[model samples]
Target: MPHPAAEHSAQETVPQAAPPPAPLPAPAPSLYDPPELNPGAWQRAGRRLLAKTIAEFAYEEILVPVRRPTTASSPVTDAPVHRAAAHENPSDPYAEYTLALDAPGERGAPREPGAPTGGGTLSGPGTPSVHGAPDRHGGATGSVGTGALPSRDGAGEPRDRAERPHLSFRARRSAYGHWEVEPDSLLLVEDGAAPAPFTDPLGFLTRARTVLGLDGATLGHLVRELSATLAADARLEHTGLPGSALAELDYAHLEGHQTGHPWIVLNKGRMGFSASDAARWAPEGRTEARLPWIAVRSALATYRGVPGLDTAEQLYARELDAPVRESFDAALRDRGLEPTAYLYLPVHPWQWDGTVLPLFAASVAAQDIVPLPSDGDHRLPQQSIRTFLNVSRPERHTVKLPLSILNTLVWRGLPTRRTVAAPAVTAWVHGLRDADPFLSEECRVVLLGEVASVAVEHPLYDGLDEVPYQYKELLGAIWREPLGSRLDAGERARTLASLIHVDPAGRAFVAELVRRSGLAPEVWLRRLFSALLPPLLRFLYRYGTVFSPHGENAIVVFDEQDVPVRLAVKDFVDDVNLSAQALPEHEGMPEDVRRVLLTESPDFLPQFIHSGLFVGVFRYLAPLFREQLGVDDAVFWSLVRSEVLTHQARFPELKERYELFDLLTPRIDRLCLNRNRLHLDGYRDRSERPHAAVHGTVPNPLHAL
Candidate 1:
C-alpha cells in the first residue's frame, strides 16, 4: 500500500543511504550431508547395478573378442574376456587361449600316458592335428561321431540367448580408480591398443573410482547390493545355495570393479595364477611356502573329477576366505532378511590352480570348459566361473581355520558335533603315542583310548568317552537287566583293542577318520559302514551267528587317495560286556572259554566263520587290491562283493548260517518299545527301564527305509 512512511519519506529518503541496511548473520550451512538411506543400503544399490550388467550380458552371447581377429560386425560389446581352445590352431600360440582343464597326465591332456590318439594304427604314431585335435586314433578305431547335441531349445528358434553362457568378466579394480578386464591371451593384445588387458573394463570402473572415490567401506557397501541381486537370481535356480555366497560374490565384483591396479592376474592355462604386476605379492608367494601334508593330500584329492570341491575350497583359502553362510545368517538376522539370503565366490585366477581340477576334467570331458595348456611351463591358465551354481543354498563355512588352510581344515568327524568334545579330542594326542604298537598303521586306534579318556575328564564333561554310568546304573537298578542287555558283550572292544595295540597304519586310518568326521559330519558315513565293516566281520568268526551294528561302530570318513581321511571306527579290543548272551548262541566257538567277552553281537559270528576268514583274509587283503582306496564307488563296491561277499557263496559250511544273517537286527528300539515291560524284583527303584521278550516277533526295522 506504500502509505504513511512511503508517501512522506520516499520522496526525500530515496537518498537516505539505503536505510542503513541491518547487518545479518549467514544461515547455518548444510555441511554437505549426502542422501540418507538405511544402514548398508548402498550395498543393495551396487548389487542392483551388478544384476543389470549380468542381465544385459546374458542377452548378448555373440562374443566380440578384443583381439581374436573376429569380424567387426560382432565387435566386442560390454563383454570382458575371450579366448579359443588349445587344439584350435597349433600354429598360433594364441589358440590355446581358452581354459584348459585336463589333469597333468589324463585322457584329455595334450599328451596323456596311454592315449589311443598318441599311438598310431598299431605299427607307428598317429597323425597330430594343427590344434583342433591331436591324432590319437592309433587303433585306427576310426572317428566315433558324437553328432550335434539335440538342441534343448525349441526345434526351430535361433539358439536362445538364454541358453548361452553369461558373458565372462574377469575384472580388476586398481588403486588408480580404473577397472580393467583380464583379457584372454595376454600375448594377443592388439599391438596398437594401450593396456588392452585392462582397457575393456576401464570405462565403468574409471568413472566411479575417479568421481565417487569410495573407500573400502564404500566398495563393500556397493558390492553387497550387487551380490544380493545375483543371489536372488540364483535362488530361482537352486535352493541349497547359502547366503554366505554374497561375501564371495560381492568381493569378486570389486575385483573387476577397477581396471588400472599396479598388479594384474595373467592367465597361462588354468592350473596356475600369477600375481603379475602386483603392488604386493600374496602371502603364499613368499619363498619356501609349504602346505601341510594333509592339505597337499586334499589338493590332490580335489584333482579328482568333482566340481566346487575340486577348487572352490582351495581357491577360497588362497584368494578370499569367504565367511560361512552361518556367519552371514547371524548378521542378516540382526538386520532382517532371514533364510533366503545367499552368497557366492568370485571366479578369480586362484580358482584356476589345483582348485580347478574337477572343473578342468569336466570341461574337457563334456567339451564345455575348454583347455589351453601352455606350450612351455604348462601351468598358469586363464579361468572362467559359471554365472550360476546348481546348489540353491550356499554351504555353511565352519572349518574354523585361516583362509589359507580352510579346505583341508574342513571340520569333519563326530568330534565337531559339540564344543566340549573338541578339547577332549585335542587331549588325545598324548594317548596316540601310547597305543601305537598293535593297530594297523591306518586305524589310529592307539590314540582313541586317550581321546575317550580325555573326553570323560574334560572340564566341559563332553561324554564321547564317558559311559554315562549314571544312566546305565539307573537302568541297572530298575530292571533284572536282561542277561544280554546289561553286561557281557564288547561294546567298545574294537576301540579298546586298537588302543592297546600300536599299528601305525591302523591308528592313522582311524585317527584321520575321527578328526575329519568331526568336520564333515560323516557325510559318507552310512556308505562307509556298508563298504568296510561287513567284509571285515565276515572274515573274523565263521561258526557262530554275529552282527556288528553297534552305534559307535558304524562310521564314515574322507577317502582322498592323495590324502585319505577315513571316518569310521574299526574293531574293538577294548570292550566290556554290557550283558551276557543266552547259552544257545554261544554253543560252539573256537575259543575254549564258553562265556567269551566279545565285541559287536553274537549274530555276526556265523558269517565270519563261514566264509569271511577264508575269503577276505585269504583271497582279498592277502593279495592287496589298490582300487579299494581310490575314489571310484563302483571300484569300491566291486571289491566289497567280489573279494568279501562272494567268498560266502564259495564256502559250503555257511549255507545255513547265511539264513541267520538275513534275520538279525540291532536292538536300537528296545528302550522306547519295552520300557514298561521290563521289571526287577527286590531291587532299588532307579530310572525306569525296559525289557526284551525272548518270544516276541520283531518286524525288520529296515523295512521303513
Candidate 2:
C-alpha cells in the first residue's frame, strides 16, 4: 500500500462535480514471457536472499555457526595469513565464522589454484568482490574474504576439509547480539575444492536443510515460498527506481516501489497467488483497477462505524458518488431485492473470482449475495496487498478488502470478529488520543482511524471455530481515513519501513533523504526518533496501550525540507493491544473493543515496541546508518535510548509505569520471525493465527545506555 505518508497535490484534490463512470480498462495480454526473470536478476536476488536467510536463521538459533578464531600470521615471517586476523584487534568488532553443512551431492575434484570457480569469483586481500551491482556504500552488499580455511581442530590442523561443504563469512555482532553478515563475503568451499561465491539461496537451503531442522514437507513448501519471494525480488530489482526519484513520488505511488517486509525471509511468499495473479495484484505490480462491489444479505453481513458513520447509509453517501449508488440500487431492484435488506461493500477482483464465488457459490445462487458494477474509482494496491489507495480521488477513504492469500505468516484475510469491531476499536483508541493533551497537542500524532467496516461471515465456517482461521475471514472490507487528506500542504509521509530500504544499486533511501534535508545524518536521525517515540511512549507508559508500530504501521511525516516531524499510525483494529492489568485508562474502552483486542501483561506490553520497532525495524536500520553515513552503530542505538529517556524525563509522574513497562531491561526475549515459519507454524492450518516464536534472549541496546 502507499507509504502511510504520501500526500496528494492540491490540484488533484480540488472539488469537482461528479462525472460519468469511467469504463474499466481492458485486460492486458497474458504475461507468458515475463522479462524480469532473467538469469542475472535471479542470481542477484538469490545472493541477497541467501545472505538474509543465513543471518536471520543464525540469529534465531535455527542454524548455529561456530566462530572461527582470528589468529594473525605474517606473510613474510610465515605464509600469507588470513585477512580475518584483523578481527583479533580489540577495537575490531568483526569476526569470522564457518557453517558446515551436509554435502548435497558428489564433491568435485580440487581445481587449479587462482582459477575462477564456477559460481562466482573470489577476491584478494584488501579488494573484496561485490557480487551483483555497484553498491554506493562500498560494502553494503558485503565484502569477499580471502580464501580462508573452513575449519581447524584444537591442534590448528585442518579438520576433514575435504569431507563436507562449509560457508565462511565475516560478520559483526551488534546490539541485542544481532549478527550482521556481509553478503558478498559469503564463500562456499566443498571437499578439496576451491572456495566459490555462495550466490544460490535455493541450493543453500537444500544443503542446510537438515541443519535448519526442516522436515520434508515443510522444506518443500518453504522452497516454493522462497522461490516466489526471489521472483518478486528480481522484479523489484529489475524495475527499481533510484532513491532520489523514489523520494519525489507521492505516497500512493511510492508504495509500489517498496520491497516487502524487512525481517521476514519469505516476505513475499504469496502462496495462493499464481505468477499472473501476482503480476496484476501484488503491490509491486503497481497496477490500479476499479474494484467490484457486492451486496450481502443483512442477515449474513454486519456493518460497524464510528459516530459519524453509525449507519451504512452515511458511509455510502460519502464513499459512493450519486450515480454509482443509483446503479447499485438498480442492481438490487432488478433482482427483486430491497436495497435495505443488503449491505454493500467492495470486493477485491481477485478475491471475488478466486474465493467468494467458489466458496460462497450457494449464497450467490440463492440471491443471498449479488455482485454490482465497480464504483468507478480506480485504486492502487498498497504494500499490504489487500489495502487499496484511491488515486482517482485522493480525499476518499482507502479500502481494505479480505484477500485470502497466505503471505508472510498468515492468510491475508480480516478476522471476522476484528472486522466487525474495527470501528468500535478505532473510536476507543481515538478517544484516548483526543483526550490526552500530550498526544493530541504536543505530539499531534495522526491516528488514521478505520472509520467503517462491513463483515460478511461464511455460511458454514463462521460457526466452526475448529476450522482454519481463514475460512471465518472470507469476505470483509474496512474503510480507513486517507493519509493524503490528513497531511498539511508542505508535508509528505513515508512508512518507517521506507527508512531502512536500500535501492537495487545498494544506495540507502535514508541517505537520500538525509542528503536532501541538508542536515547531519545524526541530526536527521534524532528528528526521526523524536517524531516516532514520544507518542508511542505516551500511549504505553501513561495509557497502557500499544500499537505494533513496525515499519508498515508506523509512518514518518516529513516537512518541506524532508526532516521528520511527526508520526502517523494505521491498522488499529489488528495491531493495537492493551495491558491485561486493567488500568483506569482502559475504563473508557467499549465492550466490543475490550473483547476483541488482545491484551498482554504490562511487562510484555513493551515488547510491542521492543520487538516491533527496535528489533524489527531499527535492528536493520542501525547497521545501514553505520555503513552509509559513517555513524557508529553504538551511537545509532544511543540516540534511540536517549529518545526514550528524554520522554521518560518529560513525565516524572509516570516513573512507576516506566518501571512496570520496562524497556531498558538487560535482555529481552528474542522474538523470532523466521523461526515461526520454519519450526512453530510450518505451513500448518490452525483455528487461530500464528505468532512470532521466542527462541532466546537478546541484549537490549537501550539497557547499555
Candidate 3:
C-alpha cells in the first residue's frame, strides 16, 4: 500500500532551476589543495598557530611559564618578531603577536652542573614515550608529513639557548633554589618572543618536552595533532576572504569559513584524514560534493521519530518531494529490491568507501545493504566534520552521519542510544519551549529539532561488553530541521563561533558587525548579551534544564541593522542537560527522553552556562572587544553581569533556583580539554566517552561583579 504524503514541505518554496552540482575532476579533484599547501602558506599558518598553542596552554595551566618583570638588560635576539604593541601595524611584516612572558628561567645559576639551558619543564605524570608509528593501541603516529609533526630542518638536536635567535635566557630559582632554564624551554621562550612569520609549532613542541614535563609518548602525539591543526589553518588562511567578505556569504557558505572552537588548541586535528581527504571533506575545504544515499534492510536497522513522523514513508515524504520520492523508490525497484523492505539514508561519501565498505561487506554481499545513485543535492560539510548542510536545497534538513575519525577528544561517531532517542528528546524539549509564552512570543527562540534518526547495529559489536565504542556507533544518521526558513524578513543568523573570528587583515568579525549596526561598541555588546543570556537563564531556573550553549550550539540572530535580537539553539539530544533534582517541569518527560538526557546536580549546572558560554565564548570575545573596540575587560564583563542581574530581577519567583545554580562563584572549576587528550586518553579508545579534566580552579572573572 502506498503511504499518504503530507500536503507540502519546506521544499515547496525552493526556487526553480536548482544550482547544478559543480563539475568534478576526472578522478575527483580536491577542492583547493595544491596552492593552499605551499611552503609560505604553511609557515604563516604554523607560526600563528604555535603562538596560540603556547598562550592557551599557559592560560589553562597545562604549561606553567614563570613570569618575571622585563628589564632593559633583557637579552635581545636578531630573530624578527611582531611587536606586542602594534597588532595591525602595516610596516610590521607579521600580524599582531604578543610576548606574555618576561625573562627565561634564571641565568648563571647552577643548571644541575652539566644540564643544558633550554628553559623550564612542562612536567606531568612521566609516561614513557612511544616512537615511530603508533601501534593500533594508540601510542603515536611517527609524523604528519608536511603538516609539521617533526621539524623538517632536523629533529632531536640539543641547540643551546644562547645560540637560538628566537630564544632569550635568564635563570630563575627552582623549587630547590638552584636556577637553570632547560634547553627545551629555552626554545619555547624564543618562539614566543619572535613569533608570527617565523614560528614552528611541531618544532617548538619537540624542544619543550623537558619543560612541558611530557614523556616521549605524549610529546610525539602532541606534535602530530598540532601538525594537522596547522594544515587546516593554512587552508583557512588561503581563503583570502576577510571577515567582512565572509560575513556577506550565506549561512552555509559562512560556516565553511569559521576558524573553529576558540578554546580547543588542536581544534581541527582530524587524525584519520590524509592531506587529500582533508582537502575534499574538511569544512574549511569548502567543497560541495553530492552525497550517496543507501538503502538498508529494515530488519537490520532501527529508527525512531517524533509525533508527526510515524513511518519511514512519512519521513521520506516530508523530506523529499513527490517527484524525488518516486525517483528514489523506482531506483530501489530497479536494483531488484523491495522498496518497502529497506530504509533509505544519506551516507558520507568518505565513510561509504572507507569504513562502511570494509565493515559491512557481509551485509552488502547478502543484499541487506544496497547503494543508490548520488542524491544530486550538493552539500557542504559543516564545522563538525560529520554534519553537512544541504546547499542544493537551502530549506532542506541538514543530514548528520557517523565518520569514524578520532578528533579533539572523542571518536566522531554518534552513539546509537542517543541517535535513536534524538527525535523524542527533540519533541520533549520543543514542547517545553512552546509552553513558555516568553520563549515563543517574545524571544521567538528557534529550536532546530532533530526530527528523525536511524541506527544500524553492528552484527558483531552490538551486544559485546567492553568493546571500543566506535564499533557500536559506526553507522547512524540524524536529520535536523534547518534554520533558513525559520528566519523573519531582514533577519540574519550566525553561529556564536563567528563572533570571535579575526580576519587576515586583523579586523574582527564582531567589530565589523558592530560598525554595520552603527551602535557604540558597549551598547552593541549589551544587546548581544541580552539576546543570548535570558532564555538560557530561564531554561535553568524555570524549567530545571540547561544547554551546552557553546559557540557552535548557540546561534545569534540579528535584525536588518546587524544588532543581535534573539538566540537560537541546536544539538539537543546530545548536549541538553537536565537537573538531577526532579521538578514539576520534567514530570511529563517520556522515558526515552529521561534515559538519553544527561542529568547534572544543580550546583554544577551553571557550568553549562559558565563554562560553555561565559568561559568558552566570552573569555575570548571579551579580549577581542577590548582590543578592537576599546571596551575594557572590566566594562565588557560588567555588561555581562548586568544581563544576568536583569534576568534575575525579572523572575523573583525563581530566585531560589538562581541561587542554587550560582554563576558568580569566586572560583570556577578549570576544565582542561587538552590535558584529557595528552594525559588521560592519548588517542586511545575507551568504553566510556572522554570528559574534560578538571585540574584545580581559575579565579572566576565574574566573581564579585
Candidate 4:
C-alpha cells in the first residue's frame, strides 16, 4: 500500500489565488518568558517553598531541626542566628553566633524580641504550628519569622545597644526547644552552616546539605527542579490577579491561575518541556491550541467504551458533530484508507512532533497511522498537563492523551493496561455511586466516568517487563465525561485545588467565595467540610473502595450562591484502589476488573483521604482561614473533626469498617513526595512509577478531636 503522506502529497494542488502578503511572525506569549526569571520573585518563591520543604521534611523526620537556646541577654532576633560558628566544633556547645536578621522592610522584622511572660509549650505536630500557634491570635507569630522582633539592618547588622528591648520569659521548652529564630531562611541553621539570607534555593540547600543528608548528585537535580518551580511561581505572581479576580474566571481559565500541589515544593517542574513547549501546553500558559486527530489501523490499536458507545464510530459520532465527523472520515478516505478499519484518536500537538512522529516512524511509513487535520473544537489544557477541556463545546468530553513528558514523579502518559480497562473501571465505580442511596440521592456526587478509551501500545516495548513503565504507557487516550454536562441549573464546578489558591496579594479563593456567599467564615467552612467529608468517608467504609481525592482529582460543585454543594471525582482508572481484603462487595466484581485494579490494605486506604485531602490541602488552608477569617487553627480543625464525627454517627453499620480504616489514628504515615525526588529516585528511569516515601509518622491533628 502507498504511504498515507505520499498519497496526500500526490493529490495536493497549489493555491489558485494570489499569495497573501507576507505576515510578521506572531510574538510569543509572556508565559514563555522563563517565568519572569527575576531575582526578587524567584528568590521569594524559593524561600517560601524552602520554608514548606523544611517544615514538611522535619515533620516527616527526613530532616530534623534542633532548637537553639534563647535567653534574656540574647533574644531571638528577627533574623537567622548563625549557630554554625558556635556549634561547629561538634564538641563545643556554644560559640560566637552571628545573627543574620531581617532588616527594615524585610521578612521577620519590627517587633518584640523576647518570649511572652508565661509558661511556653510546643504546638502539636506536623509542620511547626508556629504560624497559628493559637496564642498568636491568628497573627503571623509561629511561622519562621511570624513573631514580632525589632528590626536590625537589612544588611544583617546586629541590633543597637540603646534600642534593645527587655526579655520577658525566662524559658520555654518544646520538641524544637527554645530555639532562637531568624529572618529570611527559617531556623534551618546547623553546625558548620554559613549564615545567609534566603537568596536562592540552591544556596539554601547547599548550606543545609549536611543537615538534610542530601548527596551532591541529589542536591544538583533538586536545584534544577526547584528552579523550574520557582520560575512558574514567578509567572503566577506576575499574573497579578487577586483572588477575587481569579474567582471570576471560567473553570478552564481558573485552572491556569492555580498554583499546583500545595505540599509538593517542585510541583510545576515540567522537566521534559522546553520553554516553547511549556507555552503551548502548560496550564499556566493558557494557550488554546486545536489538536489533530490520528486514525490508527485497527490491527495496531484497540478501543473500549461503555454500552452506549459499543463501537469507536459511536463514540466519535457523539464527540463530533455531523459535519466535522464527515470531514474527518473524508480526510482518511482521501489518503486511500477506509475509516471503518481505523480508530480515531485525538493527539496532543506536542506529543505528535516530539514523540509520535519520530518514535513511530515505522508505523507512519507503513501507512498504519494516518495524521488527519484538526477538525473539531479548540481545547485548553487543564491543571494536569496532558488533559484538555473542550472550550468550543463545553458539553463535549474532556480528552486525556499520553504526552510522554516527565512531570511531578512519572511521565504524563496513559498506561496501556489502564487505558484498555478505563471504561470498565469507570462502570464499576459509577455503578457503586449510583446504587448507594447516600451517594445517589443525598450527596449526589458526580463521577465523571472515563466513558471511552483507545490504547495503541508500542509493538516492541509492550512485551518487555524490563522496559521503563513510561514506554509502556506512552500511547493511549481517555475521554471523560465533562463536568459541565453533569451540572444542574445555577451550578458551576471548580477543582478542589482552587479553594486553597491564594493570589499575589495573599487573598485566598475560598475567602472570596465565602465573601460572595454572604456566609460567615466559620459557617461557610462548615458547609465546605460538610459537602466534602461525608461522601468521601462513606465511600471507604461502605464500599471497600477509595479514590485519590487529591486537589486535582476532586471537584467541588458550587451553587449560584458560591457555596459548595457536592463533590465530583474523575481520573478514576489510575487513582482508584480497591481493598485487598475480601469484601462481600467485591464478590460480584468481574474477573477482568479484578486483574487490573490495585488492592491496598484497609490501613493504607485512608491515606487517600488523609494524606491526599487533609495534609495535602487542609494543612495549607488552615492557616489561611486563621489569618483571613479569625477561625483559629484549633477551631478550624474542630469543624473538620465535627464533620467526620457526624458522618460516622450517620453510618452506625459501618463502625467496624471505620475502625479498620481509621481516620483518627494518633500518628498517620507521612507521605513524603519531595523526598522521593531528592533521594529515593533522582531523575532515573524505573520499571515502575514512584510513589510518596513514608519516612515516619506525623501527629494526626485530627486524632484527639
Q: Which regions of candidate 4 deviate over 4 angstroms?
A: 1-35, 70-196
Ten contiguous residues with the weakest lDDT in model 4: 169-178
Deviation of model 2 at 582, angstroms: 2.1
Q: How much lDDT does candidate 4 score?
A: 0.70
Clashes of each: 134, 5, 27, 10
Can you give the TM-score per candidate against the true fold? 0.20, 0.86, 0.81, 0.80
What would the per-residue lDDT of candidate 3 be over residues 1-705, giving only the tens digit for each residue? 333343355435667897899987689655543677788778767766765676556444444433323555554322222212211121122121122221233211222211222432222322222211122123221111111011111234543433333322232221101112221233333432542233677876654443344556666677787888887888888775786787788888888888888778788888778888988999888899888888889987888888878677788876776776677789878878888898888888778888888999999888788877777789999888899988888888899999988787788988888999999999998998899998888777889999899998778887886999888888879999998899999999999999988887768999999999999999999899989988898888998899999999899999999999999988867889889898998999999889889887787778778778887888778767866999876688778888888889998998888788888776565566766665556777778787665544455656654
- Residue 475, candidate 1: alpha-carbon lDDT: 5
When sorted by TM-score, best at the front, the candidate numbers are 2, 3, 4, 1
lDDT of 2 by residue, 136-218 (tens): 11322111211222344223344554555778788876766567888888998875778889888888877666445566777
Residue-by-residue lDDT tens digits, candidate 4, 1-705: 899999898789665898898999898765535646777777666656665555554444343233334453754443322334221211223222222222223322222222111111112222321111232112211211121233443344655522322111111111111111122534333223443254455555554443344556666777777777777777777665887787778788899988888777678888878767776788888899898888899988999998898888888877877887788789878988898898889998788888888878899998888888785588999999999999998888999999887778778888898899999988888888888899999999898999999999787888899988888887778999988878999998899889888777667888889999999999999889988988888889998888888899989999999999999888967888888889998888877788899887788788888878887778767767866878876688788988988999987888899888898887666566766675557788989887666543455667774
User: Distance from true position, residue 437, model 2, in Å?
Assistant: 1.2
- Superior by TM-score: candidate 1 or candidate 4: 4
Each prediction's RMSD over C-alphas, in Å, is 27.5, 15.9, 15.5, 13.1
What CA RMSD would candidate 2 show? Answer: 15.9
Error of 1 at 535 (Å): 4.9
Please tell me which predicted candidate would have the highest lDDT against the true structure.
Answer: 2
Report the candidate with higher TM-score, 1 versus 3: 3
Candidate lDDT scores, in order, read 0.24, 0.81, 0.71, 0.70
Please state the error at residue 668 of candidate 3 in Å.
0.6
- Model 1, 301-397: lDDT tens per residue? 1121012323333423432234443443354355443433222122223333433333244432432222221111111100011111111112211
lDDT of 1: 0.24
> Which scores higher on TM-score, 2 or 4?
2
